[model samples]
Target: MTATAEPRVLKHQALRAQLETLLDGMSVGDPFPAERELAERYNVSRETVRQALRAVLLEGRIERRGRTTVVAQSKVVQPLMIGSYTEAALADGRSASRILVGLTQHTADAELAAALRIAPGAPIAQLERVLTTDGYRVGLETTRLPADRYPGMLDNFDHTSSLYAAIMARGIDFERTEETIDTTLPDAREAALLTVDARTPMFLLNRISYDQNDIPIEHRRSLYRGDRMTFTTTLRAG
Candidate 1:
């Protein structure tokens, strides 16, 4: 390789190290060194700086929020692999705790029916809870499970624990899943539960979980603290 190639590789590696340092220290909204500053610090061209930052962006470590690429706190590196929520949280050293807000058995609505792939009038178990970190309210989740899957699911587990974990204990394969995430403003109930002011930007996560037979097992909507949590997905260059 030419001398130019070696420096290019070194600069990329250095940038990766710097980005990891930022992730380990800062929260979302924290600004990074200016592009010009990065070029100076790394002894590389501005183009190199841009390329390095693009790597971080692809990894969901940083985002273009405003005039700057801001660091994301708790960049949620969700693998394409299917795993339990509690497993992911504990593996990342995040405080995973829940408070039961409401529990009921009800007929599915239009939206729930569509997501759960069930009839509108089908019976479902509605589980609502608040998820917290370090004793601070961080998010809220409301899950709908078909009543036929678990005869008495609403009465089975304590709401403070992970429902997926509890469900697996019953020999149900709560193993496979799919998720879609978007940002949205919080409603009155969601705002109060998350302890954020109404209209605060939230990470709206819509998840669909399936069993081994590809049967929809869990349909859920969760609202996360936009400032404190960041969702990440890995992508490949096309």
Candidate 2:
């Protein structure tokens, strides 16, 4: 005799499909029907509705608000390139803003020296900023520049403005950037700044931006809240 699918499994699958059908044509922020109503409409138990919603939540298809759920906003699309969240948010029709947290002089460590192509212990200019989209704080960006390459950067670059804008204003042409992406749990301070639970994971991205001569001009590490972004990359066959 063939093994049979359990009744619970079949019911849950049917309920999940029913919920997806109900979600059709809904606006991104539109609230999902209340659990009681969903249970009655779908002829399933409240637990069944919760089970269905769990799958959707994991897929980032919807998000839970206080006492309810809503269709999630589309994930931010990021092509692999030299860019900033400030620019990316605007491209997606969202307002981007920056808050300069700190700016100071620092000495390069072994890792920074290699990425910035500066001698270890050389003086470097460091800047930190928080990036927000429509008031939702999404990323913390920390950047360093070899002080010798961009003298007076502390005074010349407007920390509140776009970092790329300031570098270009100083006549340094930005040619390209290389980046590495990873993920990890937010630190205590990062969790507080991001208003997320301490266990919330974040996207950690490091970049080395180069000038026309292939000289590295900037080295940056940006930590992004995982809930708000979905990085996308495209690959083509050779």
Candidate 3:
């Protein structure tokens, strides 16, 4: 059974390579060839073509649109560094904007308290927004800050603008940040907000930003669509 499976795997891999080559010549949003046509051109069975196409789809080289598949737009590359989403999008030659979702004040729970190093019942200002790049919804972000530390933040801060800029305007600055990244699938509400399938994979980012005195000033949780964005970093050899 193992021997039989190996050849099938190799065949699909080879077919996937050919499909990628085909995609290289196509422009973004160009219609991908039908499976029947691909099978005929490659002299393979339709099932083999289907398997190859599935692999390509998973790689984000192509996407399903209604009843057709088309070449996908290049994923936005976000550097894993201290920067604002607007700054990163501008660097990529894309326009960035945000839709204000909600803004409210709440008392910090035990989990939030530990993360921000504040009292469990301390007043916290929570801001939620949907991030967009080039008019496409790409991420959702929720940011929490100590309400007492940033007085009038809920009323003065513009939810649609860069949060970092607003913080700087208040004479507050980020000295450093600690961030973690993981993968998750969106819930139904999140999927509807991001305009993605509920099964779509997402990049979950949690960050804690600190002041010059190493005090945690901000806690942020963000979710970015895996198909529309990617994270990059530079590593130095020690």
Candidate 4:
């Protein structure tokens, strides 16, 4: 009688689990097994192994050089800011720049909806750009604005120019802003677009800026290169 074949596991998930195990047993900078060898031992496709490895890489937990994956050191914190990126860099003695990607009008997603204080599916103008300092690409920023507040905004300014500066020129003074920061790994697309290897970790910032009338004007989410930038903040007692 012929025996039934053993069930196959989802290779990516299995590989991810194994990576977590290996990481728990090692420290940052410790070398891991070669990717091809790991795939062979696990009896999985190389693509599956890569997918699993990418997830770990994104968390700043691992680094890949040549063909090997190694653990990565922790990322540092940079202070958050609620003002213009240009101002922030100038204050730190770094030159600031923006490289415009594109702009389009779209309805808000769930997350954008809450940030803009608008109903889900409300029309909004989305702008994408790279935030640079001293000619080095430091972060990627995407800003969304409610269309009703700035109709024809896309036609008026170069996105590489300061959106805040241009908006304020139109009589919308940016009164203040709130911000939050966290660490995350970039996806394959984002990694390529940001010109960073997938192994490099990133810092994510979610910020909302308001007008003088206390109306929310701009909502931005930025991803900064983990190794190059530090987010710092000064705390005050209430």
Candidate 5:
């Protein structure tokens, strides 16, 4: 890169770090300064300020709400583990709740049956819900399981409680899971559920859980607000 371009990039990065440090002290409801004001304060062009804002926004440090940009907390970090969403939120020292969208039984189709290793047309339970923290919607989770695997699972499960406990009650223990994450802009349905713009970026997690016997017991597809959720992966030196 040219020396000219290098300085410009470094200046932008420095401004972003400055903005982030400023935001770290503010509470969630605190309003951010106007772009022009921020530019003047940072002694940068409005365009530079915008670029810095874009960097922080992509990092999920703050978000625009309605007509105003406000401070939001750092993304809720979700470690790869076999735990309920509530547990994940609590681990971050936040309260977690959910709004149940629906729970119903359906006949498992070819793909669903294969995924669960069940007979075709077997009964399956589909549960859809939104996960929230501090009264703000952050994610939509949809999970499916073979109904026969956990008889009367819906009838016995509390809608607001930990899914891990619910499954354990039915003697279905989940020992491990494989999860894959991908990114997309929220569609209309997802946007409405998450209370974000349709063009808002998001992460979609597809997790398949297995039992002690290595049998797939559940399939879950969760769409999380990219601006308010972050995922963590652990690595060890070999």
Candidate 6:
């Protein structure tokens, strides 16, 4: 009788399960055992240990800091509804903040004009900010609005505060929004600003919000870290 060999993938998967079990007992920011130590402890080759760690790393269970890998914090749960990042983070029991990168006014180009339903060369204000949760960089957002409609926006609006709140204070509330989500890799500038690798995966979001009159009020582009953010939505049956 011939004996069947165990598959290599199954071996690595078993090792991964053991590693996850070990992680359950570890605290966040605790350094993980070195690869050599893990290999020796598991009686497996170093290559197998490496293969087993890959999935855990991608799942955000572990992260590399300097030269050491350590247990990571849980990902922030973001609801796919009309809300601000600050509100979402708070719902997840986390604190959120922003670093204002730039705030300026410029004439709308053809693309922006079409999106905002305004004539070309109309004045628009752009607000760029970096979104952080619990002091860790997690996302980048850029918002554009018609400057004529919101006069003194660049000079009066506090960039660090919630844009949605500021808009509501002006007596304009968002009635609905159309959003599209996709996956992408960070560019060099974005990688630096987000403090992530250029190859790190990102969730790209494009949104256009409308008021009660069905007039577009805001246009925004946002990128969230794939490993640190998870989007959720409720489903309804018809």
TM-score winner = 6
Quickly count the clashes in candidate 3.
0
Two-way lDDT contest, 3 vs 4, winner: 3
| lDDT tens readout by residue for model 6, 55-107 | 78767788767678899998888898887889878878999999999998889
Task: Please state the error at residue 193 of candidate 5 in Å.
Answer: 0.6
User: Which residue runs of candidate 3 sit more than 4 Å off their true CA positions?
Assistant: 1-11, 33-51
Q: Per-candidate TM vs. native?
A: 0.63, 0.75, 0.86, 0.64, 0.85, 0.88
Residue-level lDDT tens digits of model 1 in 33-145: 78899888768888877777766665656655546667755444333445555567777787677889999889989988887889899998889888876565767888989
Clash count (model 5, backbone only):
0
**Candidate closer to the true structure by lDDT (higher is better), 2 or 5:** 5
Q: What is the lDDT of residue 179 in candidate 5?
A: 83
Runs with alpha carbons beyond 4 Å of true place in candidate 5: 1-15, 21-25, 36-50, 236-238
lDDT of 5 by residue, 93-149 (tens): 998999999998899899888888899999889999999987778999999988887
Q: In candidate 1, residue 128 scores what lDDT? A: 87
Name the regions of candidate 2 deviating beyond 4 angstroms. Answer: 1-58, 62-71
Off by over 4 Å in 4: 1-79
State candidate 2's TM-score: 0.75
How far out, in Å, is residue 49 in model 5? Answer: 4.6
- Residue 165 of model 1 has an lDDT of 72
Please report how far candidate 4 places residue 209 from its true position, in Å.
1.9
Q: Write the per-residue lDDT of candidate 3 for residues 1-238, one digit (tens) a residue.
A: 3465443557778999999999999999899999889999999999999889877876778876657889988778899887689998998899999999899989999999999999999999999999999877889999999999988766966777888988877787789999999999999999988977787789999999998789998999999988788899999999
Question: Model 5: which residue pairs collide?
Answer: none
| Residue pairs with backbone overlap in model 1 | 28-73
Per-residue lDDT over 1-238 for candidate 4, one digit per residue giving the tens place of the 0 to 100 score: 9879987877697889888887898986788877788788888888998888877765557765556667765533345655677887777776778888778889998988988889999998889998777665668899889988887777868766778877887899877888877889989977866777876778888889988898899888899987557767789999
